[model samples]
Target: MNYYECMQESINYIENKIYEEIDLNEAADRAFMSLSNYYRLFFAIVGCNVKEYIRLRRIHLAAQELLSNDCSILDTAVKYGFTSADSFSRAFKKATGLLPSIFRKQDRQYMFERVDIMEKYFEIQDLELSEKYPDIKVLKETAPFYGAAFRAESKTPENDAFIGLKAWFDKNEIGNIMPDYRVYGYDIPNSAKDDGTYGYEVVVTIPDDFQVRGEGVVKKHFEGGLYAVTETTVGEIVKAWQRFISWLDISRYEMGAHQCLEEHEVESGFLNRNFEEPENIRINLYMPVVKRNQTEYGKVIVDPVRVAYYREYGSDSEQTAHNVWKVMLNWAEKNKLDCSKCKIYMYNHGFAKVKDFWFEIMITLDFAFQDNLIKEKIFKGGKYLTYDTSLSQLVSSWMKVNQYVSANKIASGNHQWVEVWKLNNWRFPEKGIMIMYPLV
Candidate 1:
């Protein structure tokens, strides 16, 4: 077995016996390694000694038990292998910065969830690409990836490439692991032969320590970098590539040093499930690109508010967005709205074409204005990473935000991307806007 699978098995064993007296030697035996090797691998992969991981995991799980059940502190400590209540409290407070008593009363997020070896070392957050919205491109950066590349030459490049990857995994008895990894590929840049065929390489993510062996497969490493990504299905992929080329032609960023990739991975968290698949699997096309100019953007936090909004659907031109603001301000004027006390924010949405888009112009409403006539929604005030920049700097600012999100491992929630004008200074408002992305 590969080291990752062995480490995973040992982690599983430790988790199953978390409540019992865990033997470090026994854990080593489970991984088929010596005690020293086990400790080394565990520390290298999990980033903590097994004992520390167990203690924190106990505190994390105990925090849950303290809130849900009426178990005494001493009983909880005994259940999780702590010798006494005092020992448990010290370890818990040291890890969570709160006493067990206080932690039970307060609700907040914790970082001591059980460690999954595969996810910790190999997983990356994929930018959930929109298959239909050809205009809304997402900027993403992948870490240096080690993959098993399966080369294929065929008239049907996509199908042949995927087949080779799956067959290799199944033959090697690792097909079950495919769901936990990513599959990406690219057509040979300039290798179209006269036989009406092309070369495509399918890449499967592998652990850095895992060595691969197969007839037509080889281990390859990529120096991952920034990519402007979009999604399309098997039938419409040709158009997707065209869209990328067209975007780069006018965009501030040009293509970069790496090959463009088409990747597929399962998407998690809040999203439109309808766009996921209809037996027509989706593909995220990534174009490696570099910025032509350098600029710095400031980061800040934005508070949420209840807002009444007017949505306008129009072309992708700036004039359409301006018209949305005009319609919103006209309605607010008719209603005698107080702009000084409230803020206005706009959220743009993409459609099937770059020329078609939709935007919502919103005004924060007070408790007294709740009864007024307009569509109202409460924005769950949460943490956000934001920047103050002009409309022309929108793409670069969002790229900065994307970098922050990925670095911080922030999870995304239902779409609430907001760009607002300066406070009550609405003159030629497009000149200045605060671009904000919600963080969860």
Candidate 2:
């Protein structure tokens, strides 16, 4: 069978024997490869070693048993292949950030599942590129570059940009487009081109001593940032981009700001289309990336919710919100308020730094039961960006969402970001905090 099929078979073996000791050598035999080769292929395809995958799967199964109240924690641990309850608890805490006991009693449930290598491999749309997949590298930064940038800011900029730059080369008989000039290309980020327009910039790095010759080529410095880079042959470079993007989606990183680059290193013979032995040339693709937030979130539309609220200004939002929550609870108890939702909205004053921020604590209330003890208002719901996260590092998740809004150029419908407190937890997320930001 093929390599992917073999890996799937080994995964099947792992799942079947998770409650028992799995021989690494036996797993390799199932894949029809040496143990070392099997390990290599598994890591490349599954993004983790085979042993770690099995451990995670076992821990996941163990969690279910603990939550079901069907087995004691020690019994669950031993059944899932841990030698002792202590060993199991340590493993569980390392993988899931909580002890088995704490996790079982926690209000919010954690999401974990077995990896399906076969299905994941088959789903890659650019799987054809696997025949010659380029070796990828995650770079913290690239060297500073000063270059003359040629622009194609139009409705179809990608193709137009290349054509425009190529035409410039042809017009001047500029042999400089070759590797000697260090040429690069990228999609211009966040430009106002969504109105039936696109934007791309092609640049060739130039030395300080080099004389300028091209017309309408603007020269500038491009300070680089984090990038996932790969080198592919000229014939495969374009399609390689699609494959690279797919890789990033599953990886720990997400798209970030700045230029996503295609740096060309052409053979000396490359000028027009017909170059001698063209296969010798290569293109290095650079996809800007940032560490992804582990929080699960998406776009949602919320209907208007009516709530009774208390507003205050505080620098420490969480502590301040906690205090306001106590007051809100007292008010609700006094009024015998029936609530549908509990929410908090914190507003920014449109400044870089502020000593204090305005926050409102509220809960959805029955309109029929009027209460004069607090201010009642209808939260005019619209399209929003929302996420579900645990209390641990909750502030980082907020920072991530804000960064996402900025990186993606998201248009905000309002200045305040809403925190959705207390969910049902029976579904994807029932009893955890969900944060929502207004999106236009």
Candidate 3:
């Protein structure tokens, strides 16, 4: 069989064994290739590894089962190799952005589409080296990364152009540095890339207390922020990069001064596993961003209120806010520290520049928490300007607030701005938000 046919045969085998534990070696044998050859070919064509592909297929089928049969979440999770309901829910939500319960309720397409293996091959072969637009996503702050940095140069294509970093890791015995096997590709700015070949730091995350002791190794912290993320494979990376830049043209955001981050084999499951080559690697591209246009949406006034607050440092404002409120609301129910008024105070002005991000998620408290970390603070009433926005429009809306402040000649007060989640649902706020900024 040809390459495509062999791949399709292997795909058929996977489909047949969707519920069962799939052995990679057996799949490779079915494809009539060694494990390495099968992995390389499949990743090249499918843009994911063997395990990832299986997860996608299994989840896709599980979605179908959830829709068609009267299956419980736990039963479905057990059937699909998920450990628990929470794990299944998290994985499902990560993939489809909806919980299995909600996903089952929605009447939508759930089946996995069969790949046209030959068609994709021909498309890639016929694809010219030209601009290819990427589907960009505005991601909220991500998990922090503490890793080592080094300058690297490309040498051999067969060895994935990562031989330099690999050599460095070996010489330094980097296994002693961190037990984790994940490797990240950090883009170095203004570095040499004369011919579409650039330098990057192939770094791995270390513990917070880990000390660095080596030549040319620098400890760097990627203070996560709002990022414009897109996926690109090694083959079309150059074109994909150009396309990402092009997307920024029409995008609501512009690039920031931060270096781009690429996710390679930077997860636990992927450690120690070698790909056929770096060219076969699929990477998610992350570019820091700022507002492109600052338009004033105008502002309104705020009122004084006593609130019970939970202060979380270095948290993603988007995701963490919801969880914080959920916990706080539950606490209020138990403690009777209840009031109808609830609003989140953003102290760091992450809406303007999201670095070293911190949040003070608060709910109305008649009495304060005696705990030092979670205490009550009175929002001194003041004349405030209001700008409306949502998580998606946060950056732009903040820019609008800035424009309003400049044009109206209003000085902001020392009081922290309040983000009002007025919607009945915090997870998906269809009506957006109101930011009440205290004026001087």
Best by lDDT: 1
Name the lDDT value of residue 410 in candidate 1.
74
Q: Write the per-residue lDDT of candidate 2 for residues 6-125, one digit (tens) a residue.
A: 677888888888889999999988976567556755775577778788888888878777787757888888888888999999999999899988888893355567666545543232
| True-vs-predicted CA distance for residue 301, candidate 2, Å | 13
Q: After superposition on all CA atoms, what RMSD does each candidate show versus the true structure?
A: 21.8, 22.9, 17.9
The models' CA-based lDDT, in order, is 0.66, 0.64, 0.61
Q: Tell me which of candidates 2 and 3 scores higher on TM-score.
A: 3
Q: Which of 1 and 2 is ahead in lDDT?
A: 1
lDDT of 1 by residue, 1-440 (tens): 33454678998998999989888888988976667556755765577877788888888888888888888999999999989999999988898899888887786545678887656543233233233333435354557878898877666665666667777866765434432355677765333444556667888777787789988789888767677766566557788777776565555555554556776532210011122332354556777766644434444555667887777655333566778877777767767777667678877653122334566878887754543435788765555556676653455455555544554467865647787776454445445778777765
Cand. 1 Cα-lDDT: 0.66
lDDT tens per residue, model 3, 1-440: 43445677888888888888888898988876668657866775566777888887778988888888989999999999899999999988877778999998885565556565645442221122223332555554455667765655342222342454565567767655654334567543222232344345666666777676666667777665566666666566678667766666555555543446665633211334355544655566666665555434455666778876776543234355555566655665667532334454544335233333345666655554575446777777677777666754454455445544654477879866667655342333445677777787
Of candidate 1, the 10-residue stretch with the lowest lDDT total is: 266-275
Off by over 4 Å in 3: 1-135, 152-164, 171-181, 191-200, 265-281, 290-440
